[model samples]
Target chain A: MRNPLTEAFGIEYPIFAFSHCRDVVAAVTNAGGMGVLGALAFSPEELEQELTWIDEHVGGRPYGVDVVMPVKTLDRDAGIDDVSDIGAQLRSHISQDHWDYTDRILTEHGVDVAARDDGLEEGAGLGAGVLGWTAATGAPQIDIALSHDIALLASALGPPPKAAIDQAHEQGVKVAALIGRVEQAQRDVALGVDIIIAQGYEAGGHTGEVASMVLVPDVVDAVDVPVLAAGGIGGGRQMAAAMALGAAGVWTGSIWLTVAENGSSPVVTEKLLGATSTDTVRSRAYTGKPARQLRTAWTDAWEAPDSPGTLPMPLQFILNSYASQKMGATPPRELVGMPVGQIVSRMDQVRSTKQVVVDMVQEYVDVTERLTADLEG
Target chain B: MRNPLTEAFGIEYPIFAFSHCRDVVAAVTNAGGMGVLGALAFSPEELEQELTWIDEHVGGRPYGVDVVMPVKTLDRDAGIDDVSDIGAQLRSHISQDHWDYTDRILTEHGVDVAARDDGLEEGAGLGAGVLGWTAATGAPQIDIALSHDIALLASALGPPPKAAIDQAHEQGVKVAALIGRVEQAQRDVALGVDIIIAQGYEAGGHTGEVASMVLVPDVVDAVDVPVLAAGGIGGGRQMAAAMALGAAGVWTGSIWLTVAENGSSPVVTEKLLGATSTDTVRSRAYTGKPARQLRTAWTDAWEAPDSPGTLPMPLQFILNSYASQKMGATPPRELVGMPVGQIVSRMDQVRSTKQVVVDMVQEYVDVTERLTADLEG
Candidate 1:
């Protein structure tokens, strides 16, 4: 708890709660731990309003905003100025065979997205925005984040953009990036990132094959920066494990998804509540990247041998975004999932986010006391 | 610290050090933590001698014996009653194509094994004992183990046989089994295993895909029995994490390989000291089963395309065991390597087994003190 994360962020504890809901973020900060809001699905205007609301509610307590800016992306074209422009590029690149494959799976599940959408990109189920992959989209989001009195700016996909890093540093906001490998962590430190969030394969969303037990200490040894261990970190024992591996704190996302005030769909929450740690699989169907999600019929179909290969980045997001949300479908779970760590199975209850944070801190103290007794004896 | 592991074993600390060397086991027990001697490399007679040595030196300090009694193995013939019978089955089932492939790799690397031993089934580099894969071999080792006044009988690969568990309990010795998944832990508990070793993928030799952070808690939640955390556990912080995840103690193996009085070759120890966490790969090249080992040319060749696929256990082991040892080569590292965990990177120096135990306890105290100070503040 006396590590770099608590000291740098000026927080009582280093338990990081990652969620998209503004309420959860404000609540976690109001408690001892820090809250990080995921901004992938947010428009600049929407994100601004959300941050504005969070600032007012947090009572000057620190919170962070996470943006997905992958270093390797499909929208590399400098001319792409907007999400629509990226969508146009995406529509042009995805082949008919891929569409047929996605459509066949959706229709078989009873969604029939191709027929329902009427050739428009508009879909009812998808929340909002697409392709946070490019800097064109992520830059404006960073501008909005810097405008707010945020304590930290987190990049999910890869190293944060140089411009984003400079802007955050200039605004006195610490910059952090999540990495799955030791090489990426060294690169992040070389690029002057303030913190490295070392995520393991058991984590939700995009991840690498290395587990946190190995990756946390590996990243910690390879670089001089502080490391926040992510993936499969849900409770006090996991937070203690992170610190044992030389990590400054724990960066958790999946555990927050089941919290009472979470912004995720009820379908996801229900699936998660009944799930075990082994129920999650790393599937590329949700987005172009290989992200860990619940093993639904959707994930099984996309992984089947006869299915079409996934499109890269924005193209996949653009082609299957509507279907992914299963907008207006009678059954919500036909295509509803999000990135979550292997810790999903332990999330069987709907506790308040504040309770989750409080329990973790208290459990950490209790566990340490138990361990220290043996050490002293 | 004050959990089932200590209560069941009467050890001051719940740390369990797993090693093939009896000296290291004796040292660990003398240092307050429990030591477990791995019996995979010993014949019945050799094992008896080793156990006798441990008993004489331990000053009545309790210790455990670990025998690899996998539930399913390549040698499945119930009528086959001996190691030579299994060896005959192994020799017949192996294709010459495999022998030629193994020989070719060795010869090309300047390690011609045929001329040195004149077709004898022995080599200098691979320590000792050919097969620990089946009950045919492991039962005899267990018989030797039970003859000694051991405190515990631990099984690896799968659930311990009912006969073994019942006999151990009848003899007033506890039975423990190592598991990598929640289902395995439940099955072990149902079978009345005295303790569960929840080993993550970060462990050496045989392992499952789940990490310690996720697997430990999942297993802890599933079973009411005592649990020991293994894999990527070389120090105190990891011990605290295991306790947090509800494990009674930490079970470690790889860290002992580099200890001053270890049984492994100095060549392997030097390689381990110089290696990083990513330097290991889970390959069936050495043992038929996928055990993590130093990433060498032998492992790479077996894992690569355009090569003959690895043979099944006992069969593949009987055919190529001699060649893999690399009896004598100038470069030394032509094919020599040993089983190790991803925690190899942290073993930057070689210390006494007693010093490691002392340091771990000290570091555990330091970490908890730091965490508790913040919790109270």
Candidate 2:
């Protein structure tokens, strides 16, 4: 229970929970583990609201905010300065063929793509394209996060921009970057990032080819900073494995999706609960980069022979956002899926976020005790 | 240093070394770890010679033999009985287009495709198509293995055929199967296999999507038999992590490639020594199934847009064997690659097999002691 991460963060355990829901974040933080709220789905104002809610609910316990600041996004090359125009600018990059292919697949799946705008206004819901992935959009979210009483700032893709890292440092917020490669860990540490989350291929969102068993130790060896193990880690035994691999702590994502406070759609929750590890796949269909998600008709269509391939980065998300919106309205159970890890197999039951944290700590303790016993006897 | 695996196998350490070289196997066995010789590349006569050499060298120390008896193969559906005719029969099933594509890639790479038959006869060398993958080919290898003094018989793909399991058990040889998924592990154990090697996506050769960090504990939980953690495990820390995740031992492959006794070509050994974890990729280019190998120009060509997609199972291997043959005569340093895992990053030096085993055990002891201290203090 006590490690560099626990001692540094002043937490009861070294479990870091990443979730988009404010309730899950607050619940995990209140339960003595650090809860990191994902800021990708929310606008800057919405992120501020979420952080304010978490701040009030957690009663001043330390929590973190995770933002997607990818180094190789379309907007990086497009040179869009205005944050307001960023979404429209990125959307224009999506080819007509890609848009038509997505629509055709959705229509074939019985999703009413034509009737997608029946009730919801354009860019109203979670399907809003290019939601805070680029520097133009993510910078404001980082600014909003620093204004709050946040303990950590995590970049989901690449190194948080130098300016953002320096700003977080000025605010006494530790900056962490999620990297799948060892070289990326070195680069992130050089950029003044405090912690490196070595995410493996089994992780939920965007991931690298290396697995935690290899990447954790590789990152731990390459960097002077503390490295948090991410991807495919759900419970205490996995946490113990991460620690054994020299990780400071475990950064978990998918396990939180099915928790009682998760606020995920019941349909997605059911699918996650029923899924085995094999049910998930690393597909570029949604994110343009390989992101582990529940394999569905939607992913399959994009991978099919005749269908046009997915667009890159922000463009893919923009194009797929329409299908997501349509599916959200009609709820094509088969086409509906979420980014999840191979650990989805273990998220079988719905428990409180606090209960999940407690179980993980208990199991970690049990595993360590067993390992210690093995050493002596 | 002792666990259920060490006790069960009567070995000083629970480290399982897998290599195609008999010298590496014997050296590892004599060094107090169990070395399992990969029987895929050897004919029954060749395997007999290798095991005889190992028996002579190890002086009755415990060792194992690994075979590839995939439950699903082209031969399984093709109904080929004669082992000698199996190659020609399977070769015929490969499309002419695939043959041309493979030749074209090799020819474009400055390889002398026409001069392939200059020094090597067809089906004379390692590039011989369909090497002990199917039941017909692999069953003989298993028989040859059981005839030897191997302490363990390991099937690299599916569960060892029921007959092979019974045969090995009758001879007091433990049967182990390598699996990537939990369901596969369950199937393996249900088939009366003594041990399950839960290989993750980070492993060399054929692997499943699940990673060792996730797959190890998942398999350990699913089966009654003791599980050996494989893929991406090279050093002592990875072994400790695997044990922490509930594995009885660690089964390693990539690390042994660079050992002094490995007998790999100097070109491949040099590539492995210099390669980082990211340098290896899982591609079905060489094998019909996805196998992790060094990302050379050869693998890149298979992944290129102009190249035809790889064929399935034995057919792909059959087609690529020609390119492999041509490359063998005139070594293309950029085109030459071998099956390797992410742990290839750690194989930066040429240590003796004994030294590698000693170092791993020392590291395991150090890690366990550190964990114990962490718990106490």
Each prediction's TM-score against the native?
0.89, 0.96
Predicted structure with the largest TM-score when compared to the true one = 2
Chain A TM-scores of all predicted models? 0.94, 0.96
Alpha carbon RMSD to native, model 1:
3.7
Local distance difference test scores for all models = 0.79, 0.84
DockQ scores of the candidates: 0.44, 0.72
TM-score of chain A of 2: 0.96
How many angstroms is residue B251 displaced in model 2 relative to the true structure, after the best TM-score fit? 0.8
Once fitted onto the true fold, the runs of candidate 2 whose alpha carbons sit more than 4 angstroms away are: A118-129, B118-129
For model 1, residues A260-329, the per-residue Cα lDDT tens digits are 8886667777888988877888888777788888887778887787978787776666656656444554
Tens digit per residue, CA lDDT, model 2, B1-377 = 66777888888888899999888898888989999999888877888998999889998889999988777777788887777666667777777777778778777778777875764343632242366777666777878888889899988778777988998888889999988888887877888999999999989888887888888888888899899999989888888889988998889988988988777877888888999889988999878799999998878988888877887787777666767777765566888888899888899999998999999988887887777666664
